[model samples]
Target: MLNMLGISAGIAVAAYGEARFDAFGVMLQLVTITAEATRLVLIQILLTGATPPPAPAPAQADRDVEMGLLGGESSASRPVMKPQPGS
Candidate 1:
């Protein structure tokens, strides 16, 4: 809301400051800005509504070995040796 107001004020200031203001040219500029804003908004909407691509499935063998889920020895079960007292 604040940004829109700032943009509107800026455009108004620019148009008002023009020494030789042409009504037709000003109108054209306003229309162009409106069209560009609309185009950007539509592009944003389309992009946000778009669906992402499907992810590929893992191999059957790879799936079975996942974290010992199938009752097999998993990498997580490996024992780690602690360092001796001194160094």
Candidate 2:
């Protein structure tokens, strides 16, 4: 809030110095235009936050089913493959 006021004051002073009073008024309009756009963008980003989409649910397996649809049933878990940069 205060930051925007500072910016407004600075622009008013500078525009008045560089141009006439009418031109300064025109420049001030631009300040409000940009400030409004900035405020809206900030509000949208803040409301959304950094939320990630929910992941899909895992497929449920039946213990009594005995085997996978592919007929491959392993008592041990699958090995986790670590990636190598070159390979």
Candidate 3:
């Protein structure tokens, strides 16, 4: 809010200081500045408004139940096999 006001004031001052000021040029500058500011504000709103979903604690509980049903042994709990002494 303050930043935009400062930028607009600066442009107005610059335009006032110019001896051969062009109304159309100043109008275009103001329009472009407004558009860019709007774009930035919208982007900030979208980024901060969105949030990721929470962790799946229920899914982990389901997996624990499945492991219990499977004789307390899942593929992940199995030990790796070592190479035989021969062959």
Candidate 4:
């Protein structure tokens, strides 16, 4: 809600600036308004817990490596070290 209000205020200010200026102020304000609107939309999406679609599944080779990591097998193929005698 606050983000929406901020975006609305920015647009209102931009409109006022455009009306009062005869130079490039209007163009700059338009850019500002657009940026603010974009920010507001992203914020709203985040606050609403919107998530991007899941990525496609990995290839068979990639999945196999990932499984090996989780299955207690190191991908580097290094032998596990044993504990030595304590000091």
Candidate 5:
């Protein structure tokens, strides 16, 4: 028999690691890091940026996305969409 198991790890990880896995956040991070690392290497192997890199933004910035998923009606304090008369 084929069985599927749904562990809470994914949910927990997503909740905790939103910045790294989120599209708007870390999707570009991999690409950018690679380029920066390569450029730094080319220019000077020992060169390093003095200032720290900016903090990564969460892919799912709004917690409402997870909250609103219970149904079409979103309970998030911040409305992702304008409230319409009806669906």
Candidate 6:
């Protein structure tokens, strides 16, 4: 709320300065004021504890592999390979 007020005040001052001085300095001051207000608003939002969206659910294949590993089950019931004496 205070940020909004500050921005409004800055705009009013800039308008007055433009009417009186008609110089580039007033435009620069207005830009600086706008930038500061934006920075303050961002900081206020951060302080208010904004959070990111939740992650997506795991895929079906990934869930199944996880469950199998936890349950001590092999992916396939195949015989173990043995080494030959010579190639």
lDDT (10s digit) by residue, model 4, range 1-87 = 999999999999989966786657667879999999999999999999999998655674576578687885533455777889994
Better of 5 and 6 by TM-score: 6
> Candidate 2: deviation at residue 67, Å?
54
Span of 10 residues, lowest total lDDT, candidate 4 = 72-81
Q: lDDT scores for all predictions?
A: 0.79, 0.72, 0.83, 0.80, 0.61, 0.78
Candidate 5, residue 41: the lDDT equals: 75
Candidate achieving higher lDDT, 3 or 4? 3
Instruction: Predict model 1's lDDT versus the native.
Output: 0.79
Who is ahead in TM-score, 2 or 4?
4
Candidate 6 ranges beyond 4 A from true positions: 1-20, 52-87
Best by lDDT: 3
TM per prediction: 0.36, 0.33, 0.35, 0.43, 0.26, 0.35
2 or 5, greater by TM-score: 2
For each candidate, how many residue pairs have backbone atoms clashing (under 3 Å)? 0, 0, 0, 0, 0, 0
What lDDT would candidate 5 get against the real structure? Answer: 0.61
lDDT (tens digit, per residue) of candidate 5 on 1-87: 123233565667677886555576765888899999998776674455355567544644344455567554434345576778885
lDDT of candidate 6 over 1-87, digit per residue (tens): 999999999999889876887558778989999999999989988999877787545664576578687985444433688998895
- Residue 81, model 2, lDDT: 71
CA displacement after TM-score superposition, residue 68 of candidate 6 (Å): 37
Which regions of candidate 2 are displaced past 4 Å?
1-21, 51-87
How far is 27's C-alpha from truth in model 2 (Å)? 0.3
Candidate 4 Cα outliers beyond 4 Å, as residue runs: 1-20, 60-87
Question: Which pairs of residues clash in candidate 5, taking residues 3 or more apart in a chain or in different chains?
Answer: none
* True-structure lDDT of candidate 3: 0.83
